[model samples]
Target: MEALKKLFVEFLQAPTQENFLKVRNAVLATEEFDPYTDAIDGVPKMMEAGELEQALEVMKHALFPNLVLSPGAHLNIAFLLHKLGREKDAAFEHHISQLLQEAIEETGDGTEARPYLVTRTSDEYDYLFAHDLEAKGQALAKSPDGTREHDVLTTKDGGQIWFDVTDIRKVLARRMESDGEASE
Candidate 1:
């Protein structure tokens, strides 16, 4: 993960598209970077238990190892920092999250032919959340060639958005295959 760490450091120092893209590429290159499972899974529980500092520590562990390259992690970090009254740091993390969101948006237009590319399923919710939208339902779909997979989210406002989840599917498939092999 040294490559990811280097790219992440560069992105943090410059916050430029070039550096951010490098980090994104590195993250998408592997199935190991899971923002939800690695960084965010325990956050809500911690928050509900009134453990804000512990939540921040969880994020720190995820971020220090470059295990999360998701806007969701930064957004959570921002919220925790804000709760801790670290306004300046919170603002910085919030800004970084926004930048990461913009980078994700630049990947596609949310159309079936050009669906928004996401490394994790939660990113679909993050995109909807960022836009003040709510998903009423979701379905998995495939391209005509059956090569690309997408998550189609039906919005509360009677609209639909599509997220290209081909890579995520591949990762899940790999996990399932490994599980089957291990069981056998």
Candidate 2:
């Protein structure tokens, strides 16, 4: 997150086309990157071409997981979801977009050196999960003992959404292991 904040600050300070392309290319070089091949990289164009389902699938799966670090990407997804009559999904993406926008705004007018903070509080996670369940008109309940302790959210229809923090740690561990293997 601090990396993203720094990137945004650098872009703001320079504000050149070349700088923009450089930043964009850096993002695209990430392992999770996927090209927006349909219609010049704009979601609106995909919608205009009657590819709403494809657009939604790409935004939800491919883009959201990878591009959540980008405010513009969130905004684009939100706009596309709204146009496709998915108001709840749009609202969630808009919330994320606003959060990213606030992070950028807190960087102080693009003039001075500002400390970028990447603090993830429990409240933020609670808010995200709560809003998601509410958007689906489902109630959230705690799972009983003997189940996966990380299974935090259970819906009224017996569906579960597990948000295990250890999962992230494992992913990082795997990445580090792979990186070490590559360097060897």
Q: What TM-score fits each model?
A: 0.86, 0.40
What does candidate 1's lDDT look like per residue over 1-184, in tens digits? 7777777878778876677667766776655654336545788999999899999998878774343556777899999999999999999889888877887788788989889877678778889989999999999999999999999999999998999988777767776787799899
Q: Which regions of candidate 2 deviate over 4 angstroms?
A: 1-44, 115-184
Candidate with best lDDT = 1
Pick by TM-score: which candidate is best?
1
Q: Write the per-residue lDDT of candidate 2 for residues 77-179, one digit (tens) a residue.
A: 7877898898998997887666655553343321112222111122223334434542223222223443221323344555443332222333445667778
lDDT of 1: 0.80
Give the C-alpha lDDT of model 2.
0.48
lDDT values, one for every candidate:
0.80, 0.48
Q: Report backbone clashes per prediction.
A: 0, 0
Residue 66's lDDT within candidate 1 is 41
